[model samples]
Target: MALQNEKNNRYLLRDWKPENPTFWENKGKHIARRNLWISVSCLLLAFCVWMLFSAVTVNLNKIGFNFTTDQLFL
Candidate 1:
């Protein structure tokens, strides 16, 4: 069942056929590209956050954390 809820700006598509050229030309391409970029950006941001902690830990002594080299390695 295809339902369009204008008040909520929601469209429920019961069937999806991306192979249909008309649909892809009209809407699918834009949606797909937008989602792809969003996903890629989120992944990159997550990777940066994950790596930032390691960088901070490596410089903990410089920041006055009093961590020894051995402790830093651990």
Candidate 2:
């Protein structure tokens, strides 16, 4: 089981020595850019959801849903 798990995790970066220039040039740069773009995309998605909720809450009463102000904010 342990050997199987190790084989499964062979591609995982357990040591992560980005300070080594050769490793950085060969692999670290690609990994860093991938992680950065993933983070940026997730952040953008969260912002869009927040804006949609805010707009809906502000206009809920105008659309005939009688939620209290505190409930809307919540």
Candidate 3:
């Protein structure tokens, strides 16, 4: 299967440098800022997710279980 391998192969970009110097200098900076903000928002959103466990764990500890390292991790 050389033919099969070629068909299944994915071209991976290990080196990625955007072209268009003027775009990078001027327009690209604004676009890059927008993308950066979007990325940060996504990251913060992801962290906000699954935080219910923290609140629930705190409530549970108030009832009985203490906020042990295990509870914090869980």
User: Whose TM-score is greatest here?
Assistant: 2
TM-score ranking from best to worst? 2, 1, 3
The top-ranked prediction according to lDDT is 2
What ordering of candidates by lDDT runs from best to worst?
2, 1, 3
Off by over 4 Å in 3: 1-17, 57-74
TM-score of each: 0.61, 0.80, 0.44
- Please identify which of the two predictions, 1 or 3, would achieve the higher TM-score against the true structure: 1
* Candidate 1 TM-score to native: 0.61
lDDT of 1 by residue, 1-74 (tens): 22335444544444466899998889888778888999999999999998998898888888779978888787
How many residue pairs clash in model 2?
0
Alpha-carbon runs more than 4 Å astray in model 2: 1-6, 9-11
**Tens-place lDDT digits, model 2, residues 1-74:** 98788878846666677999999999888888888999999999999999999998899999899999899886
Report the C-alpha displacement of residue 1, candidate 3, in angstroms. Answer: 44
Winner on lDDT between 1 and 2 is 2
lDDT of 3 by residue, 9-44 (tens): 654323334597865676667666777999999988
Cα distance off (Å), candidate 1, residue 43 = 1.2
Candidate 3, which ten residues in sequence have the lowest lDDT sum? Answer: 9-18
